[model samples]
Target: MNSNHLLLEEPIRMASILEPSRPSYFPSMTKIVGTLGPKSRSVEVISRCLMAGMSVARFDFTWGDAEFHQETLENLKLAIKKTKKLCAVMLDTTGPELLVVNKSDQPIPLEADSFVVLTPDQEKEASSNLLPINFSGLAKAVKSGDTIFLGQYLFTGSETTSVWLEVSEVKGDDVVCLIKNSAVLAGTLYTLHVSQVHIDLPTLNDKDKEVISTWGVKNNVDFLSLSHTRSGQDIREAREYLSKLGDLSQTQIFAKIENVEGLVNFDEILQEADGIILARGNLGIDLPPEKVFLFQKAAVYKCNMAGKPAVVTRVVDSMTDNLRPTRAEATDVANAVLDGADAILLGAETMRGLYPVESISIVGKICGESEKVYNQDSYFKKTVKYVGEPMSHMESIASSAVFNFKIT
Candidate 1:
């Protein structure tokens, strides 16, 4: 046989003798962000996650201390070396959020219609009748007849454990409330929210500034996901703070939309920040559950038109407990990809979940499959039309290229 014929025949013969090849797996264009917590903080788990297509590793400063995060960051570095894959590190700040402190270190049960005192005393221990909040201005921010929600209301699988308190009186730095429901406060740190009361707290709390200056700057974080981002001013303040703490120009800021204020000021926030994160868990709590999807769609469209990345979180929360995601959860993730999301963030799913690797793999597969039918042509046309007029030099070039490609 001739040399060309021999080369082709040898490959055909080898294929007949060799075992069947496994199906090829392609990575998704959309990024995957996995939260690192107690379950997925080890080097081995993180390596598997990177191989499974986790583009970003998120460290939530709300739960762990500086030392704990330091160790986890070290493990992440080792995992990156082993996998030879690039993964960006994100620091999620606590922002101006409030949490309840239970000094008992155990679950506290409150009876229905029982009287409870909500105090701003950090030194006070949480008792059956007394609950201490982290925010010092809690008493002044709330008035009589206002409703207070401690812990997540629903969808967390811990709704029964959440407590509802109605403010009966505000007396000298103490807000006396009546327990509306008999729920058990299971964790030491429970999120506290007052209904219809605007808590006048600074965008960046002291804890946020300290963490960003110390651990964030020292570690050279790649992204800062600002929590509860209300306005464009919040993004400006965070960028200014980073500028003062050495050269953090490489660190991109992602404003999180989690409340009504954030939704209202999204246009301005988008202009100031590098990206957007739709924190649906808290956003669901802030608005009616049915309205969260509407806001998400609008926000994602705006991000797409602006050519900025939009990340959707809490898409596969049901996977936190089970090995597979629910039908609704699967549809939610697919729809997010179809809606033009640049990334998907798994909070409790990868952080405290039983199957962290499985979660990442499943999400990556969903994103890849969804992209097949993403209707890119329609999306590009809509984006081009929305961005008409007053185009910058770069925008003009990009639009011209796309138009030429479409015609060709």
Candidate 2:
């Protein structure tokens, strides 16, 4: 072990060990699904999102009509082609449910202490003071002490589990009464139509069905998000509809588990559905807000064990509406990724945020960091050399030796 000989051999050892492998694999990018909306639907805007690392674009079926969706799909496809990226499209269906108000021309405002009754009546206006929701047994479900929260505020009122209230407030067309303590939620996008009803079949509404068919025919859509899906039957019905429209090949189904029924029948739903989307906006209304975190972890693990992609969404914060996401918002996204979600969806963050591009960029950065932390061990393991199949064969040994460059 002379000093000169040791120094000379150290350089040779370093050169052999540090050489790159012939076929190296890198960690895959976590899919980012950006919702398509008026402000974000133009060619330039869509392109910017994709350039910023969006892998999928979601078009909510609840928003526009078939013709409008057709136009959006056309524009999205053109953008994908122009950018040379294989971005997928998702068409989210609105079940046979009803939101309190029609699409607003401007953002709706909800004041503190307001009483709103939700009934089956769509004509029920703000003055009705009665927020008529379309689900049965709704008024009966409201217990004496339940805190119902709308967009970001809580509503307070009486004993019947079916009805909720907080008397005192100015109301325009704001999305009303985010009810708490219900098995199934009412009033948000994908709110349950037959929450307490005895409906037996998949409740695909006419308007939503038409949009699903159009998006299916367009063939650009990559996923069909079944909202308010309560069972395996719902997934089956949606699949049949997609098949009818000739979209069975590549387009997949993602069942949104936002209710008690969906949570209970998860195994059945997963069998029929391609993936699961944890829609917490309405889901939190059904379960305890604290429980949502536990449930989210369980859902992520369940989907992972089943080898299905799961997406956690509704990371609503002041930033989603204002300029930046709160710390809680950041933690929510990071936890989902660490729990093994294949994707993280951006809703209002992209739909109506002041900085939609910035929102998505921040989301990407979080996702990138989470992936790095979660996959670090796997990254190193993949670098270790291993023999391939048919290890006993001489030729295979020679191939490995040559490929590894272990022998000159």
Candidate 3:
């Protein structure tokens, strides 16, 4: 027999299939983004995550300082070298978010039907009767009868430990509110949200700009995931800021769709942004829970049609504490892959979860399985139709590539 015939007759070895480094070769086209946190910040954990199919390491600038994140970055670099896998770094900005500052290390108990004073004074200490909000324009933004939610869980689901306060009066820089429910508030920083109130805050706060200019530029960040992106102007402003900082041509801006404003201006946002992140946690808070999935599906389809990457987060939140994911969570992952999501992002699942590596591996497996049933031909036809006739140069090239792929 000829050499080619002899090579084709050789059987693949099982030992090679079970190689330790085999997991590094991701089985699916859908990438995995793992957020770095206390649970997965160590070099060993991060290395395992990379081997389990983490394509990107996300650093949330909202919770950590520059020094803390720099140390985590160093650990990630070490992990990359150890695993010999290329992983991109993403900086998740805080954006125009409102937070509650607590002075006490313990939980402050607020009684039902009690009155509390909300102040914007950062210097003031938080007490059971006094709450300090980070937004300086809190008093101006809210009026009497405005409702404020203070906790992690807002409109997303049932209120667990969240405190409800209704604005009663505005006194100078302080706003007095009546507590509707009794709750114990803990943690140094708590997310604060006002119902139907539009706080006119800058898209990029001073801290966000400082971190991007300093740590982001220093680390050669690959992606900037802007939080609460409202419009295309936000993406442009971020790009301009990065340009002024240093040589960040490689840095891509990903607009996170988390609010009604973001949904309303999504077409323009998608046009300007390099990619889209469907942040369901905050989206659930902004819109009805039933509507959040609709937005996710629509946004993912739009990104696919635009030929841009779309990342879905909070897919398997229950896996944060459990060893295995629920059936619903598994279906969620599969559906996201079938929906043509380019990547699946793990927020609390990988950030503070007990099973970070397991989560990545499970997500990868689901993506690989889902890809088997993906109708590539149909998707391509839809994409071509979305682009229409007289396509641009890049679109024409992409269409040709897909056509060739189908025939081959």
Please report the candidate that would top lDDT against the real structure.
Answer: 1
Estimated TM-score for each candidate = 0.88, 0.71, 0.87
Clash count, one per candidate: 0, 20, 0
Clashing pairs in 3: none
Q: Against the hidden true structure, what lDDT does model 3 obtain?
A: 0.85
- Give candidate 2's whole-model lDDT: 0.63
Which scores better on TM-score, 1 or 3?
1
RMSD of each: 8.3, 9.6, 7.3
Better of 1 and 3 by lDDT: 1
- Alpha-carbon lDDT, every model: 0.86, 0.63, 0.85
Q: Stretches of candidate 2 above 4 Å error?
A: 1-28, 102-119, 123-125, 132-201, 375-408
lDDT of 1 by residue, 1-408 (tens): 687788775523444435533222578989999999999999999999999999899999888899999999999999999999999999999887888888778888889989999888979888889888888898888778887878743224357778878899988989899998898887676888675466788778899999988899889999999998999999999899898887676789999887888988999999999999999877877787898899989999999989899999988777777899989988999999999999999888888888999999999988887776678779977876887767789988987897899689
Candidate 2 structure quality by residue, lDDT tens digits, 358-389: 77777777676666557534422333333234
Ranking by lDDT: 1, 3, 2
On TM-score, the leading prediction is 1
